[model samples]
Target: MTSSLLFASEGFGLNLNVFETNIINLAVVIFGLYKFLPNFLGGMLERRRSAILSDLKDAEDRLDEASTALSQAKEELSSAEQKATKIRNDGKTRAEAIRLETEKRTVEEMARIKQGAASDLNAEASRVTAQLRREAARLAIEKALATLPAKLDERAQTNFLNQSIKNMSKD
Candidate 1:
């Protein structure tokens, strides 16, 4: 609206001419800021971008190191597993060998026992045979003594006694 004035209507009041004065001043301020603002804001944005890139680089390096550590750990685990398997196999083989050795010893011991038993049986049989021979000789001598008095005269007895004494002296 026309306030019937060419300048401000009051002391230090706003210039309300939208098309004539305010638009022109606002356009000049916007143009001046646009020219200078990029130099200041661009440096700040560039610094922030550099910081973010540096962080990403450090993260990538850390990831690579972690992957290397993981691979090394896997290798160590595999080596340990192989060693365990070797130890287990060795234990089983040793057990089998020990069992076989024990069996051999047992077999040998049994054989020795059988041999000793046979020897003892042979010795017992020989001793019994000797005893039977002595018993038979004593019985035969008694039978001869009982029949001697009826069968022989006094002179025959005297002659037999002399012969027995001669045989005993020679032995």
Candidate 2:
């Protein structure tokens, strides 16, 4: 090619063939970028996409496990509550039975104590009546001895003695 075709005249300086130079520079830059950048950038983007997908799968698995655990915990809590309720009811029934038994025993004891007291009172009354009868008999014998006369004739003494014996026997 002629030098004039390769170099063009310009007001500022000698201008190289502008269209050809621009085309060659663009081609070289495009080839160099394509040669190195596809491996580096492509591999980085692929790794990033793979990591994101794995993270998504792991999150889904964790969510499913959490749901299962929650359901199991709820079932266990329900069972525990049922057991607690049963225990409370059993305790109430046992307490009621014990109360009834205690009341029955108390009533029986009270009746027994009252009967014993009545027996004691009856025995005391009989003892007092016997003592009073004995005291009255002793008083009658003393009165008879004090009132008898000592000076008398044989026939008079015999009659007086017979009357005194009769009075003593009557008492």
Candidate 3:
């Protein structure tokens, strides 16, 4: 081993006097890195894990809030739909009632008009019949007054009077 170390030292043209010191310096630097690096890296990794957990908790809370709001919105939407349906049904019922009332009024008005027309017709027919009777009686009276003096002479009037007296005695 001493011969190989001499040959290695001779190959690199380095003297054996500094080799042990260089190895000792390298060993010190390696030991220092091994001792401090794990603590620093472990502290950084732990901080990162805590930050990730906090972010996950915040995300979960937001999700819960969103779910609750969605449920409330759904309930409101259903209530609005039900109210709209009820309003529509009420409007239809009111319209139908109005239609029925209008029809009834129209029928009553028609009946009243028909009754008035019939009454007017009956009154006009009665007036016409009365006028005709009065005209016929006037014509009959005029004809009799104009011809009675010429047709009934003294002998005819005496014979008619004697026959009227005989008819009165029989009754």
Alpha-carbon TM-score of each model against the true structure: 0.61, 0.61, 0.59
Candidate that scores best on TM-score:
1
Please list the C-alpha lDDT of all candidates, in the order they appear.
0.90, 0.84, 0.90
Instruction: Give the range where candidate 1 is weakest over 10 consecutive residues by summed lDDT.
Output: 4-13
**Candidate 3 global CA lDDT score:** 0.90
Error of 2 at 68 (Å): 2.0
Tens digits of per-residue lDDT, candidate 2, 62-122, equal 9999999999999999999999999999999999999999999999999999989998899
- Local lDDT at 152 for model 3: 98
Q: Write the per-residue lDDT of candidate 3 for residues 1-171, one digit (tens) a residue.
A: 354254575466433555654877888899988999779988999999999999999999999999999999999999999999999999999999999999999999999999999999999999999999999999999998799879999998899889999999999
Global lDDT of model 1: 0.90
TM-score of candidate 2 relative to the true fold = 0.61
Pick by TM-score: 1 or 3, better one: 1
